[model samples]
Target: MNFAPTPRTTSLRSPEKLRYDKATAYDVLDAAHICHLGYVHDGTPRVLPTAYARIDDRLYFHGSTGSRAFLSARDEGVEVCATVTIEDGIVFARSWFHHSVNYRCVMAHGRARLVQDPDRRLQALAAMIDTLADGRSADSRPPSAKELAQTAVLELALTEVSVKVRRGGPNDDAEDLSLPHWAGHLPLATVAGEPVPDTGIGVRPPPYLP
Candidate 1:
């Protein structure tokens, strides 16, 4: 489904880079485990980077129940903005002004609800664990009731969403393009290295680990 454009969802700066494709937005979001959550507390705006999991069209992020952000969303849903970005490369150009980073990103805006349902909360927690490794939720012990009580999960619907991407080399001016300077993009990616097991219990890592 394509997200309908809203005033907040439209990109005013780089309008050409804006996309409404929900599939592309989902891909960008799923590729990164961290999301910058923007919220307001006591009329002061704040942005916090936190781990999040996406299930269908909603996102779930958890934190200590006493956290200011969680507290702000507890009683009544709070307005929020969630963003995920994946850096693909560094764009090298003939001029410094044209240099930029190649990236895929998604921005979501909505009222974040504090999740209270037991089953939904458990599912969100499992999805979050599995994000680290395909079956990590199954390998690890489930959180105890006491532990769950101390945690708060916030849910945000992906209603006002926008995907923006910048790719290829930097946009060099026509005159600068002929200059004697190397212009190309240096590709980047996240690659997992050999797993270093923790102390005690000498068993190989599960196949789920890269």
Candidate 2:
């Protein structure tokens, strides 16, 4: 809840609005199901989009045990930049040049580590379930020994992070204010649909879709 705001130094004129507070950042992290990960591997930059979850002050990621990134993370424990962005709307301005998008994004700097402890791995697995389905995490059965052997879990400590967001109507320059182009923001959002039962499921189930 008390993180410092790192100003956007890319622009001298119109800098981005930022929500760098730690609690706000966590809110955004929890809202997203996936994050784009950036790291250096084999002296080359790598960016991969993958599913993730959060627990306490650490972010959780899972991948194939043999995945190059996963292995690299476990072996070298290199610093990484994990980002999550969700576009909420399209900002239409009077001029075509002022087009912008309303979005929430978080960029974190941390070292990724493999979850070697069995108890911690189980906790990470449960956190992952809770992230996807609130109550289902408790309703689900614990993973068997065989199942545990087949999964890989990683934890990224949240020591340094930045959360930047933009939300509002179109922004146009003074000269383009009078342009006749259509102007305003077209709202965008993720809407949940009705839950569809599995092929073998016979009776109507409770709300399970999101």
Candidate 3:
């Protein structure tokens, strides 16, 4: 499915880099586990980094029930924007103006609703854990009643979404090519390091871990 861009989602700066396809948006979102959630609280704009999970066309994120952002969102049903970004490389150019970073980003806009249903909330929580590491939810203990009561799970549909991507080498002017400075992209990636088991657990590392 293709997402129809609203005035707020249209890419006025780099129209060519903007994507409206759901596949592109989902790819960017699923590739990253963290997202920045933006909302207004008491007339002040705020953005907080949080973990998220995507199931179908909906995105789920959770926070402490006492959190101001979550409380405000739950009470008011205010508009929110969730963005996920993955930086692939740094583009070095002959000139500072041409230097840029290669990245894939997706922005979703909607009003988050508090997940009140117990079964759905559990599923959302499981998704969040599994997104961090596949099969983790099954290995870990499920949330207790008190723990669930202290958490706030919210869902936002991916109805209004946009993706922007930048890749390859820098776009330097023809005259700048003659400069002595090297121009190339330094690729970056997020890699898993050696796993360190907890001191209390003697069990071997699970197969799900990298």
Candidate 4:
């Protein structure tokens, strides 16, 4: 199913907000591993940092059936929000308060349900294993029915998602612009570390980090 971003009242920030369309949001979601999932239970708010993967227009997450959050979701089925954020660079200016960071964030709110199909659950599992670590899913043992039963899978249809972005130099106030100071942005990035191998493997990692 094709999904376009429909901004909810809670998800909208400013009128000039960056484009939160399907293509813009999915690009950020597909690149990140950890997502901050927010939901309400018993009139209280909760957020959990978890891993997620997008298969088509849906996002899938795994947890135990015994998990309090999923159990609550099963009963109440309130709106669910998941956000993926990537911090790309640091922004620095002459003024202290003007400092900021370059980032891309996507927040999605939708109906959440536990996916019970064995085949779909299997595919979601494969997605997680393949996404988190390379070559591990096919190399490791498959999931058994008992194991599957012990676990719970939730799917959030990507219907209403919003993306907000902050990039370029810091936002200095008009009065401070002519302070005759070096007001510019500082760059930041994450470099991939060299991969280490187990001695028993008797081989080195390929040119990739994974």
* Per-candidate total of colliding backbone pairs: 0, 0, 0, 0
Arrange candidates by lDDT, highest first: which order? 3, 1, 2, 4
Q: For each candidate, what TM-score against the reference?
A: 0.97, 0.89, 0.97, 0.84
The model with the greatest lDDT is: 3
All candidates: CA RMSD (Å): 1.0, 2.5, 1.1, 2.8
Candidate 2: stretches off by over 4 Å: 4-15, 207-210
lDDT of candidates 1 onward, in order = 0.92, 0.80, 0.92, 0.78
Query: Which residue window of length 10 is worst by lDDT in model 3?
Result: 69-78
- Which is the better candidate, 1 or 4, if ranked by lDDT? 1
lDDT of candidate 4 over 1-210, digit per residue (tens): 334544462344454656657787888887887898888878898899987888988998888888777887675464778988989888877689878788888888887788878899888888887776655678679888799888888899887877778889878888888887887776667566767668776467643234
Off by over 4 Å in 1: none
Please give the distance, in angstroms, between residue 53's alpha carbon in candidate 1 and its true position after superposition: 0.5
Candidate 1 local lDDT, 1-210, one digit each (tens) = 799999998866989999999899999888889999999877889999989999999999999999888988878888999989999999999999999999998999999999989999999999999877889999999999999999999999988999999999889999898889899999999999878888895668888998
Shift in Å, residue 72, candidate 4: 1.4
Q: Give candidate 2's TM-score.
A: 0.89
Give residue 140's error in model 2 in angstroms.
Answer: 2.9
Measured on C-alpha atoms, candidate 4 has an lDDT of 0.78
